[model samples]
Target: MRLPRSLVGWFYVSPLMLVLIPFFVLPMVVIITASVLEGDGFGGIMPFFTTQNYIDVFGSGLTFNLYFSTIKFTILTWVFSLIIGFWVAYFLVFHVKNQLLAIGLFLVCTVPFWTSNIIRMISWIPLLGKEGLVNMILQGLGIIDKPLEFLLFSDFAVVVAYVHQLTIFMIVPIFNSMARIDKRVVEAALDAGASRFDIMRYIIVPLSKSGMALGSIFVVSIVMGDFFVVRVMSGGGSASVVAALYEDISVLQYPPAAANAVVLVLVVMLMIGLILRTVDIRREIAR
Candidate 1:
C-alpha cells in the first residue's frame, strides 16, 4: 500500500504547519488583534476595536528616526558581516590544507557564543573604552595624546557588537554553500586556462548566490528584530524600531507596542520575500 506522492508531500509539510501555527501564526494573530484594540491605560486591553494605535505610530516623527537608525545599522552590519564571513569561509575551504586544522580554526571562531551575549558585549568595554587597551596602545605608540572617545558606547561599538555576534550566521550558510562546490569543476576551469580570479568570479560566486541569499536573510532578520544590543552598545544614544516598541511596553502601552510590532513584522516579511524571489533557498539548502 504505497502512498500517493501528494499525500507524502502533505505529510512532510504537516509538521512544519504545526510548528508555524503554534509559534509564528498564533503570535502574529494575537499581535494583530492587540494592535486593533484600545488600551485601558491600566496595563490592560479593552474589548473595543480602534485604529488609533496605528495612527499614533504613523504620525510620529520619532518613528521615522527610529527606523532610520535601525536601517543604518542593518545595512552596515550586513555589509561587514558578508565581507568578512565570505572571505573567512573561502580561506577555510580553499587555502587551509589540513582538514582538521581548518575545522579547529572554524570552531575557534564560535567560542564567543559559549558565553552569554550580554557578557560578551560588556567584555568589549575593557578593550575599546576610553582608558582601555586600544587607547593605551595608541598612546604608547605616540599616535595621540587623548583617548578615542568614540570607540565605546557609540555607533562604532554598536556595529562592532552586531558584526561580532551575527557574522557566524553568515559564515555558516556561505561555508555550506561553498563546501558543496565540486573541486573538479575548478580543476577543469584551470585545465582550460582559466585564471584563479576568473574561476572565482565566474564560477564560485555565481554558484554561491543561494548561500549568500540565505545568509543575508538571517543577518537582516536578527539585526532588524534586535533591541537589547543596540540599546546597551549605544549607551541609549541610539534607538531601533523594536527599542521603541520596548519603550511602549515598559509604559504599559500595549496597543501601541502591538502596532509597532505588526508594522515591523510586515516590513521584514517584505524584505524576505524580495530575497526569496532571487533564489530558491529551500532547494539550495536541500542540495
Candidate 2:
C-alpha cells in the first residue's frame, strides 16, 4: 500500500530525525550518564555508577520540605491563575465586541513578557521596597507609621511573581478553549431558562476541561520549577524546589544535585500522570 510519494516524505522528514537523534537524544544520554556517575567539579566524569542519587532523592529530609513547599505553591498558583485567566478569557469571548479592544486587553496581559524576568523582578523592588511607592503611600495615608515588613520575602511575594509571569500562559490556553466552545450551546442553555451561572457550570466548564488541564499543568510545572520568583520576590531569603536544587549545586554536591533534579522531575511527572489518569487526557486531546 506504500506509494513512491512516501519516499519523498521520508526524505524531507529525515533531516529532522537526524537532528533529533544527535542533539536531543545524545544530550539526554549524557545527562543520564552524568546523573549516574560522579562528576568532578571541572567536568571530568568518574567511572562509577550508583543509585545513591536516586536514594538521596527520596531520603533527604529537606528534599521533602522543598517538595512540599513547591507543591503548596504550585497548587495555589494554579487555582489563582485559572480563576483569573478564565475571567479574562470569558470577557474576551463574551463581553468584548470590539476586536481591537480585545486585542489591546490581551496585549495588556502580555506586556510583562516583553520585559526580562530579572528586570521584571527587579521592578517589584521599587513597589515593595522600604521607601517604595506602597510604603510611601501607606505612610502618607497614616495607615502605618513604618514600612510594612510583610511585603517581600514572603509567600505573598512568591505568589505575586508566579501569577504575574504565568498568567498569560494560562490565559492563552483558556482563551483558546473558550473561543472554541459552541455559541449555540450557550444560547440554548439561556433559551431554556438556564442562568448565566448554569451556562458556565454545566456547559462552559465541561467543554473547557482540556484547556484547564493544559493551563493547570503549565502553571504547576512552571511554578514548581521556579526559583527566581522566590528569589527576587522573596529577597533570596526563601527557596522553592529549584532554589533548593541550586543550593545543592552551589556547594559542589553533584550527587545530591543530580538526585535533587531527578526527584523534581519525578514529582512533576507524577503529578502529570495523576492528572492524565483522572482526566483521561487522551480523550480530551482527541477532541
Candidate 3:
C-alpha cells in the first residue's frame, strides 16, 4: 500500500525526529517546565508552579550585566572571525590554482581540531601569560619595559580564545559557499572592466552572504552559549550569561538556572530566525 505524500515525507524524517525529540526537544521541554516550577532549597524541585524564577531572572541587574558581557564577546568574536575567515576562504578559493593544493591547505586548518578543545585553549596560556613567550620576546626587543599583564587573564584573552576556536567554523561554511561560485562569472566581470575590488564588492560579497550568514549563526550561538572560555580565560573576572547560569547550577538553584536557560534559548532562536529570514540557508545549499 502506498502512503500519502505527507506520510512519505514524515517517514523520511522519522529518524531525525526520533533523535531530536529524545535529545533536543525533551531536554528543552524539561528545562521549560522546570523554569516555571519552584525549587526546594536543597536541590530538589517542588511541584508547585511559580513565576518567581523568571521574575528573579528579569528583575536582577546581574542578568543584564551577564548578557551585556556575553553579547560583547559575541560581537567581537564574530567580527574578527568573519574578517579572518572570509579573507582566508577567499584566498583559498580565488587565488589557489591547484585543487589538490587548496584541499591540502584546507586540511591544515583542521589540525587544531585533532586535539581536545581544553588543551588547545590552555596552550595559549604559555604564549600569552605575563612571564611567557610573548612578553619575553617583546622584552628582548625592548617593546615594553615590563610584562604585559593584560594578555592572559582579561577580556582580550577571552575574545582571543573564542576567535581562535571559532574561526574554523566560519571558514568552513564560507569556503564551501565560495567554492561553489562560478570562476567564469568572475572572469567575465574582469573582462567587462571590473577591477578586483569591484568583483569582490558586487559579485563575491553578495554571493557569499549565505555562507557569511551561516558562519555568523555558528559564531554567535557558540560564543553566547559558552561559559568555560569566559570563566577560564578571563580568570573569573568576566562572566557570561551561561557562566552565571553555571554558578546558579553549582549552587543548586535549578529553577532560576532553568529560567535563564529558557531566556537564552529564546534569544538565540530569535537571532537564528532573523538570519534564516534574511537568507534561506537550505535553499542556498540546495542550489
| Among all candidates shown, the one with the greatest TM-score | 3
As for model 3, its CA RMSD to the true structure in angstroms is 1.1
Measured on C-alpha atoms, candidate 2 has an lDDT of 0.79
Least accurate stretch of 10 residues (summed lDDT) in model 1?
Answer: 108-117
**Candidate 1 per-residue C-alpha lDDT over 73-178 given as tens digits, one digit per residue, 9 for 90 to 100:** 9999999999999999999988897989988988887777677888888889899999999999999999999999999989999999999988988888888888
lDDT of 1: 0.91
Model 2, span 15-124: residue lDDT tens: 99899989977765666666778766654567788776777677778778877888888888888888999899989877898878887888888887787977776677
Clash counts per candidate, in order, are 0, 0, 0
Q: Which candidate order results from sorting by TM-score in descending order?
A: 3, 1, 2
Which ranges in model 3 have alpha carbons more than 4 Å from their true place?
Answer: none
Give the Cα lDDT of each candidate.
Answer: 0.91, 0.79, 0.93
- Give candidate 1's TM-score: 0.94
Please give the range of 10 consecutive residues that has the lowest summed lDDT in model 2: 38-47
State the lDDT of candidate 3 residue by residue for 77-137, as single tens digits: 9999999999999999989999999999998997887778888888899999988999999
